[model samples]
Target chain A: MTNAPEITGETDIAPPVSSTGIVAWMRERLFSSPLNIIMTVLCGLLVIATLPPFIEWALIKAVWISPTADACRAARGGACWAFIAEKHRLILFGLYPYDEQWRPLLAALVNIALIVASCMRRFWNIRLLYIWGIGLVLISWLMWGGVLGLSYVENTKWGGLPLTLILATFGVGFAFPFGIVLALGRRSNMPAIKTLCIMYIELIRGVPLISLLFMSSVMLPLFFPEGFSIDKLLRAQIAIIMFAAAYIAEVVRGGLQAIPKGQYEAADALGLSYWKKTGLIILPQALKIVIPPMVSLFIAMFKDTSLVVIIGIFDLMNATKASLTDTAWKGFAVESYIFVSIIYFVFCFSMSKYSQQLEARLATGHKR
Target chain B: MKKVKATAFAVLAMVAAGSVGMAASPALAGATFDAVKARGILQCGVNTALGGFSAPDSKGEWQGIDVDVCRAVAAAMFGDASKVRFSPLTSQARLTALQSGEIDMLSRNTTLTLQRDAAIGLNPTGVTFYDGQGFLVPKKLNVKSAKELGGATVCVQSGSTTELNLADYFRAQKMEFKPVVFEKLEELVAAFFAGRCDVYTSDASQLASGRALQAPNPDDYVILPEIISKEPLGPFVRHGDDQWHDVVRWSLFAMIEAEEYGITSKNVDEMLKSNDPNVKRILGVTPGMGKALGLDDKWAYNIIKLVGNYGESYERNVGSGSKLNLPRGYNAQWSKGGLLYAWPIR
Candidate 1:
């Protein structure tokens, strides 16, 4: 902090900050270097050009509710939000009988709760493992039920935001442990094991999500004998888990590589087994360092959840599309897409923001 | 912090101003067909592949009931059905493409409804085929009727009338069933075949088309006798141009009327010379109908000659003579006890 006494007669002391004036300090921080000035001006112009039109179309001029298309149709433009009004429940709940949508809604709450708990720095331990396990079982039970006099809702009827959350959460949740195993195997002294893991990860990472979905939606049945049919949603979920695991394995491998040789040597000196050393010493520090990328992986998986719509899963994107068929809200496609985009952007942005916070917090313990 | 707030506020202000500008323009007016003709090509949207309805053959030649309507319109305008360029659209993409003027006409076996015509600014010409949602189940399920398939998982295409109609029908029948909805028609068919769902539900014609491909045995699946909802499928034009609507609508009506008069594409040229006043007027031997629609003297004759009449297109694509072997049920002409009764072209 700069300390200076008030100068009654001398001009040595700095002036106090004025509310309206463009201070030297503000200018130095915001537009100090040429690059800073350029970036600021460019970003400012970009925001100016894009933001207002989006906000105006999406919110200010958007019709929140209307009985019919004609009601929303004026000489002037208005979003015929009546499509959403009529089909919102269908999109949110899919074929899940309307009366039973509360089950999926509650399951979605569990995902939110688990996400909130996982983000707290203090809860980042063994308790998280418990939370994830319990959360998954509870959510699954609620979504696909045969209990408590609640009529069972088949997996095919599972959809909307809950379906998206389930796919992403379970995909990343199951993939994390599988990824660690695969990453370790890739770096193993046993050549056969290393080659196997390498092949699995490379093959999956090389293909697009659509092809994987096709294989799951089309090829999986051929692989399973006749008369043995797995639920379509389960098949998609399995494909996503396997696909995410391969990418997560690569991310985990990068984290594994960044660990100093001394940590392994220290564990070896203490006569620690490979599993013991990895679980206690290596994984903790490595995961801490790679936390940002891991969060990014989760976000990618979340976005990838939408592609399941191609295979016929009524995830949020599919739901939005289904609503468009309502005819009364046919022309309001732009409004509906913008709404879907906002839903996606909010989730992605918050995850990124949390990743930034975690990266800053974890940086205190590690140099690299 | 202040700068961020200022930028956000500025953006909101701009969007509000832009929206006000958009409001000044009129909505729900269709002017696309004239625009397409002015652009010198008819943009006719069809399906990527649905064998007898709309699909390309081995030679990359597009054929089918829906494709013929598109071609007939093209032949009427440019005097060659071959002049029309086909834009293959998925179900999700079809309506948006039409609304956005990406395609001038949508002749993709799309069902017509008051909501679709009014909401999308499309003027549905007339029902070309009367269809209804039906269920296709494997023989082993032993489902004798749609009612027997209660509590069964039924695969249905998403964003379709089939989805809502399935719910409405099952509820009315007091039947309990689970719907496994897919967005793509192809995927839904595949899923149904794979036993992802016990029953495949769609337009009866589509059910036949899909059932033809299922494995184990061709005869293993059976389409139930029940018809769930009325699917009055037809061709459509954008809303604004009443002139263009008349052209398309009359083209379809002339084809049906010609068939009712026992006129085939092979005999259309001869029929043009007939003493029958109604036939002569429709063939454009009379000037008023052709002149009023801004069409050539032989527009109806050209459509019939190039694309054939309605019956010819049907029999060639999906009727008893075709691979699909769909019976001429509700799609038969009005004189043949079907619901298809075209308004007199005169």
Candidate 2:
């Protein structure tokens, strides 16, 4: 009765200021305990010590444009972005004939378009396969131009970003199906097929990709009869495909294992053939589960394409290294590396983000 | 047990047959030359990137002393310098590329060595550039002589002859030094410039180029006036192809001889009419030299005309005209107190 007597329409007082808003958030999150306070202060000190100098070096004092390296050297401690400006073509198109650089630029754009289209769920059909087929053929024609009005440019002359994209795209395109086959073989009841798949996967996975590239570039030629040679780029491509297939097989196998036995039984009870069951039921679900890992592998493979530099294939990383070989721009390696790292990050980061979105989109069925 | 024995026998037979097949094809002297002619392009392996030695220019045209040697060979073979395809190869891949015929020849700044010449199925065509290992040190060290440094940290590339020479020189001088090694030239150079090491050792020409180009301030570092470890960098062809070897060897010689005769690319046509018998012989007016090498009568003339002489290549690539700006010391002609003495063209 005494409490009820005080029923006035007064607004409730705000929670203690320290327990709400950004100030409260800071207190609760950053200064809740001595350990947290110490960590926050240490992090703040680290940022203070590093950020300004980095900003000054990378942006404020950096030379964005210069006619020659001397102008960059004049800026001294700051980044020489002019080196990248002068060498961008050499880094992007590589030793491809300078006048014909447009071909590679177009080819790269086409490949990027195909990748974008493939990412879209609406294009997930036989039509996408046709698009990829046509896109690859066009890329090959553009790169090794013996047909049409395009003059012949040897694969040896193909390099830089276009080369990197070709290697990665073709590597994944070929390896995905091959990997699925390997995964199925590994899971087969036939001992011989299973053994062979296991051996291949284990053997390929056992060695580093560098060794595989070396074998293809160096040792494979020795085994061939003199004067009978495969194209160096082709050989390198095969090595990458084989190497990627091994890793992808394991990833697909993980996805296959995650599928419930009931799903398999359900397909079987529906009186579906093995191929039909795999293609319609098992594969769709298994591939959906593996999208995240598959994208991760793709990103890994995209970066790993840089390893072709060891075999002297002028991939993006190799071309960047080659560009630094210019005596005039030699000391600006840091800027060049950062530039290429950003290119790689853009590609990898997008793939990761797309994979997350895809996971969410495909995960709607499982939601409560 | 019987099956194992049979398998072993079959493997032995196959290996034997393979060896016999290989031996039968040994000394196919004109094989490479014919292949080059048939292909209409010389697949020349050059350094992936070595600045003054072999590296692509801004226009994506390869420009270097090593590249010139390959171009000269192509000019001699096809009567056109542009008929050359450059395969930029890493140091580890160069010898294999040559031995396996992945390249028609390797003009990749490879040093002439007994193991390479005799054991690796490659024959050194000729010395294209005379290089020597030397030390580069920051001037602030105030070190006048390499011998004066008793204890200094040295940055060198691993898996190079320079590394061995560094260890040997230090041990011979009875000086104690710590070695900081890197697998990449960029990292090694960066480390040296960052003061991680007191000395950076490489080919003297490379040091000059590195100082001139890579240094934040070229004046801050000095190449010591001591040259150790002879590096007779040269072009190489597979060993079984003697005709190809001869063509490559004489192509280099033609450049040197052309330099000796003062036959510049600009004056090559004018010099063709000269009455000098040696000039006539070299320029292929004599005809026998070309026939001996299994090339057209105008082979040497094509080389001199299209690719320029050795001295011109030197100046254009690594001398005063280039960023390297290295002095022509040991690389100069024999008459000029240097080691480049071409065998007589006749």
Candidate 3:
């Protein structure tokens, strides 16, 4: 070797072009073998086939600012975004009086703000409860508007995104604590308590949500005295709460079962009472283990709010449907639905990403 | 164990007592009327959204022929058309809402039938809109008549009389058809428009609505002339509430009777000076009619003045003035060769 190079301090020649750069990288990762080459070509061909048509339909030929549906119709096969533009107010605020829609808008914003604040670790304290209580009262005031210089709006007039948020937020807020109690009752030493909890959970879980809604909406009125009917929104909210509580209890029980027996024994060895043991030791770990599933359940319930349309409650999905009934702007259901689905996706995806972040952040003792 | 048993017994007793206290009396004739007056607003059940039948307009005001029926009833009862609140009900919940007294009356587009009237404890007030099953086909198909729809694929909404009528029509004709049924109206209409089906069948009014509103080009689809079944859509109330039924019934009849007598919203004040004895009797210029119906002397006048006659409402909502543009063929007055024969106000 000393003889070949004459001890010259020279860099080695660059590697072959086929083994580096984007071309080399593509060759190695995508075209390394015959199967890989075929798969890459096929996938590329699929993208080529679908992407342009979708892009053209969604954007290139889409009508954005047409005053009448005729302009949208003239575009033929393109998306009619002008329908959404025309009906956005109706789809967002529902049958709330048009002049006073600002109230529902304000209420929705207040709710969103509270939800955002609740997500922050800095606000995870008793103060958060106070904030939520105040926020809810304010939301009710804005929606009902019987006092404080605001004109009154009936609850029946409420619809759209505000109604959806109210249903989902209040449903989970009350159900979470109720569910924890139910989970505890199921594991209680008292036979009666355990049996009652089991019966409630099983009965609720056995039936579909639609039947529960039907019972609440259609049958409940028949049971009540004439002229004593409950508010439709309240009845639906109760149904959602009951339905969600049963599922949440089951999920919490799964988390409770996951906790090691050693941990319970350790808590007992520390002279902790039953309540203290649960509150200080068992629940924290159990609930932590269930954050992902809990978030998943929340995401599901958020979407399930759409089912209220069957009972004719004008939540966001129903509002969109009602807007479609406008003969002036019909046949653009695909655009309308796509807009709503994107809204749902944004909220659900945000919840999912936040849960992942939360899991990571709360992974203190469990991390490798 | 003893304490738990005692508590359970107590809870059961309380529930039983509560239900007994709230138990409904066999609905008396004027229960709904009294309840509506006490509540200060007539709670009327209507379709959540069926275009010209019952739907909220852009300003969030309930606008439709069904909604006008409710307003007419309110005007008759309270002398104020605005004194009505609408409960937008799905087709499934409409009857239940009326029966439970949650709604004072149901002006939803419910087709009157023997089963609904006899078995379900409901009574039809009167026919508000006379509809019938019809077919919709694309203009490209050049389908001149529904009879020619042999070996055709038809799109129809499931769990509706529309589906049954489609089957019956095909069976009677001895024609073969592939039915593409969907649970949703939107999906069924989309299937028809997408060329998945050769024809779409539903109520004629709905077909016209779908064509006028939903067709990419309104002129591209045509509703055939053939009607296959009777769909006498009307207002209905609980069977036991006969006085309430009469009030609701006469509210609609007053609108029709007013139209027949040539009384309109614009001419009602001038018609107060009408020389006709029928007009004088109906306008409450004579008092016995109101006393018989247990309403104000000016009840009929209030209805005509506030909500207008049936013809005016029809033309304004679903006829030439609106997007639906449904012809008032069978809905026209009896003297005009249509079937709308209002019973005498007296």
Best by DockQ: 2
Which candidate leads the pack in TM-score?
2
Interface RMSD of 1: 20.3
| Model 2 regions more than 4 Å off | A1-34, A365-368, B1-30
B1-346: candidate 1 lDDT, tens digit per residue = 3432343344334334542111111122435555656766687888655667765542234667888888888877778777676765555545544543446788888888776777545678987788898988899988788888779998988876689999998899899998888876656766777789899898898787566533335598898999988888888876667888887788788778878877789998888789988888878887677777787878888888888898998898888667567888998877888887988877
TM-score ranking, best first: 2, 3, 1
lDDT of 3 by residue, A171-223 (tens): 98888999999999999989999999999999999998876887788767765
Candidate 2 chain A: minimum summed lDDT over ten consecutive residues — where? A1-10
lDDT of 3 at B150: 97
Model 3 docking tier (incorrect/acceptable/medium/high)? acceptable
Clashing residue pairs found in predicted model 2: none
Poorly placed runs, candidate 1 (over 4 Å): A1-26, A33-56, A121-127, B1-332, B336-346
Between candidates 1 and 2, which one is better according to TM-score? 2
Task: Give lDDT: candidate 1, residue A196.
Answer: 100
The CA lDDT at A317 in model 2 is 93
The Cα local distance difference test for each model comes to: 0.75, 0.87, 0.87
What TM-score number comes out for model 2?
A: 0.93
Give the TM-score of candidate 1 (chain A): 0.87
